[model samples]
Target: MGLAEQRKTLGYSQEKMAELLGVDRTTVGRWESGKTSPQPCQRLALASTLKISLQDLEALLAPSQAVERGAGRPKASDHPSSGDPDEMIRREFLRILTVSGALTVLPLDEAEALADGVYRGNPADFARMNSHLWQVYQLARTKGTVYPVVRDQLATLREALSGARRGNSFPLLNAAADLFQLAGEVAFDANRYSNAAASYALAASVSKEAGAYDLWACALVRHAYVDISEQRYREAVEVLRAAERVAVRGDSALSTRHWVASVLAEALAGVGDLAGCEEALARAEEVQDLPEGSSNGGWLRFDGTRLAEERGARYVQLGRFDLAEEALKKALDQSSLAIGHSYRRRGAVLADLAVIGARHQDPDQVVTYAREALGLARASSSGYIIRRLRSLGDEFGPLSRNHRIAELGAEIAALRAS
Candidate 1:
């Protein structure tokens, strides 16, 4: 049975259990929620109070994924029985558990060091893995393909966070911030904006605690994307402005401040603030001089390579089809615009060109570009690409009677986003 079931089976409320165990009621609650495991001393008392052996208690503490309900015991008992040798071995096992348990509850560097001896991967490995995952995320056909990795990464990071000592917490905090941002990106890509917002907020809080200015700014900028994706242009502008202010306090070498400006450009264009958009784009250009190979390349991956696409998309919003066409075609020519590979980015450009076609009162060009984009969208299974095609479809209302346009509209409608 689950820990909560065991507690109730023994007729012990969390409050009473906490009092008997000399811990907080919330600690008991966390134990029940799988957020924490008890210390060895607490385990001894808990096993006695719940009338279970240590082996059964260990099974109860196993992570949900590591457990099997029906197959609870070993097929055959292999333990040595009632010998002095076996007793000595059990003593050593309990001793190691005691030290590990003490370390789990202690909030000091020495305790953390002792726990590190248990050989879980270090914080640097975590940061490096998260970076690679972000590259994979960008290159993945469907963004949701990255979630299982993100989820596992978050679980590992949570274990580290719960065991962190204050003196040794800077790396853990920074890692948490980076991982939380990655989690937010996965959630954002999946269109789970509420979960995305919460993850971004946690990242910002942890980054601030670590004095990680760039990480903090990135989180706030992501929070702004939640606003922008919902069409809250004015709110997004406010968020991006706040992020920019935070970015000013970040390292110039890292391009955090400039990246904020890049997002601000999109929000400004969304609101039809042409002058503001131009200024923001100009500010984002400063990233060219900052540095290279510095981005975390996972959550903080703003190198300004997509400026052409951003500029074209902004121009599309501004109704400057001539400028949009020139910029978007150039964007489509870059190596980043491969058909099936960079479908999300490439499809977006095609959709913009199709919009430009619609703007010019050319139904044939609209159907032509839109059809290619729809094909890429289907191949990629990208929700963002599908959304872009749907947006372009809105402009085809005037030409609804045109056979090809109507057919293209129906094709876009039939996309199942598998």
Candidate 2:
């Protein structure tokens, strides 16, 4: 039987299943009707709730023969094979999570060895998988969806590390470092600052042990970001300075140093050091000279593409509304920001522009930008965007008394509550 038949056999109404899965009832309906498949993050829970193996769940969700024939859809075999490397990595990741519970009941040594043998998981495989997960995390509207898989991967990494021989340990340590940074990102996006801080600390520690200078510096930069987000500019500057020193020892071909500089500029601006902020921003702009592939795209995505927005944000922080608006408008015109490719970035830019409006006492401009930002926050379900909107709402000050601005604040408040 298909998903619908299976659901009925299990006596689960669509609403009941939706409630259990923490998804909308319509989402469940679409899954059963084959209009959509469960996301990677939803697959584990869906499989557990439906009392089926993940493989079986995939079968149920597969396009039916009749539908395939009617719609001229490609046959299953004609599609990417399950044996594809990426597919194998994903399946292996889920399998590890599924059996992790049972592993905990076994003797520590035996469990570690068993986990090691299960996949004989190569460091390269883990690295590739970690990269894939980062992409998934970036694209997912609900960043929290990545937590389960990331947790499972961390558990697996711990197991591998526990039983690893001395010769193989370094690579595994590198992988662990990379994964921890991702975990920190997921936590940071959720506004779990403490968790993010802890994760970044672990990442930096492991990266240092692995002698991966770039990774180590990147972790420090991320750790510093938590401080910047909390408005601890002095603390952030200390961390960023350490990161800067570490990055100097890393591959100059990479943009690690430049990325650190960019973030340092933000911290400087927060502390009202306009000259220092400008100097750091100029240093960051040197990233434009780096060759292609300067970034690994997973942990270090900074490529000069964000300079305009970053400059604008720093200007906003320093109360330079004229410079801020000019830079922010340029950033807004970028294809990714313009087309809403990254809701977080676009929302942040919009919020910054709204703040400029508040500074100018222009209620119309504030409402225009704030409204668009709020809509993006709601659509993306991004805590990062919500945080930006919250900051924008605070900027309204006396303008919050304005009818349109007050209404906008109310909607933002409601969104935060939800």
Candidate 3:
């Protein structure tokens, strides 16, 4: 029998199983759905609670993945979610009153001690660790590969929260807020928008409670990206404007406002507000005047380094190729060459240059950059990059009589099919 069948036979609802195992109920849901497996540390506990032999549990887990996710089968009507990771995240957090029983009930002294342990480490240590995770995230080929590490960091933060007293929550709060943003990034890269939104919302809420205004503003900006992804440009602009107000009240030592303006430029561009987009881009460039080393890289990655690409993308949106190509080509030069260094970034810039080339009626330039971007999208395995490539894919239809352009179109179609 599969996991659901076995759970049914034992008269255990998902909540009951999670309670007995003392883990998030979402973990149980993931296991039941074959979306994930129990970690090695938890396998014994899972097997014991299920009242099955280890071999039998393995048997159940192994065959169930195919039965559940091999496609060509009808999903349950009521569940309304098949394999979307965002649904898993939303249901998991939505179902929880708190992360775990221990967190909900731990004594203040114990929580204080846990927070104390976290505080014992230098705040810079946590900042650096978060910064490194961003570097890794940017360099990874498959972004979902970062999810496990992000989840483990999340568990650690929750462990501290379980033992934290109110007065002791400051440092823990910083760590939690930063890590939650990272968690959101991972979910976003995996195309799990609901999960990303939830994480960003929690990050903003917790950062506000902790009185970390810059962090709070940063979280709001991250949340705005979800709106942008859905093409709700007006909504995104609203969110960015709100973020701007919050950031203005934040610490000037941080580049929170500058980051806000950078994203604001993109949102403005999305709505075809050329003047607003240009103003926002100029505001983002104010970061260059901030004291050197303004970014901790954890919460503040925009240190004016991305302005070139941002400007290029904005101009592209404004249909001003005359201004875009210069900035985009510069962005391509400034982009990294390290192994697997987020080909998505380079791919995006290249894709934009190709679009600009198309607008200029330069088919050869279009094919040249488009093919390079397609290669990066293939190598990086980033859906975001592929989506950009697909935009160019559509524009190529008019040029398909050119065999080279036709060939490139076919390749993109093949990639989408795969």
| Residue range 1-418, candidate 2, lDDT tens digits | 8989999999999999999999899988877776555656678789999999988988886664235344443322222123233322344344333333322334445433443443465676667667766766766677777776687677767777888998889989998999999999999988899999999999999999999999999999999989988899999999999999999999999999999999999999999999999999999999999999999878888999889999999999999987999999999899353442588888899999999999899999998998889888877788888888888888888998899988998999999897
* Model 1 Cα lDDT, one tens digit per residue, 99-118: 33332333344433432332
Sorted by lDDT (best first), the order is: 2, 3, 1
* Model 2 misplaced regions, further than 4 Å: 1-40, 43-118, 336-340
Give, for candidate 2, the lowest lDDT window spanning 10 residues.
Answer: 74-83
Candidate 2 vs candidate 3: the lDDT winner is 2
Per-prediction TM-score:
0.70, 0.77, 0.69
76, model 1: CA deviation in Å?
24
lDDT of 3 by residue, 1-418 (tens): 7888888889999999999998888878988877665643356668888899878887887755455445433232112122533222222221221222223443444444433343344344445445555655655566665565456546656665677687876877887898899889878766679999999999999898888889999999999999987778899899889898898888897899999999998998999999999898888899999998888856677888778998998899888988999999988888854333357778999999988877777898998899889988777678777778778776665677888888888888887776
Each model's lDDT: 0.73, 0.81, 0.74
User: By TM-score, who's the top model here?
Assistant: 2
Q: Count the backbone clashes (under 3 Å) in each candidate.
A: 0, 0, 2
Give the per-residue Cα lDDT of candidate 3 at 18: 92
Worst 10 residues of 1 by lDDT: 74-83
TM-score of 3: 0.69
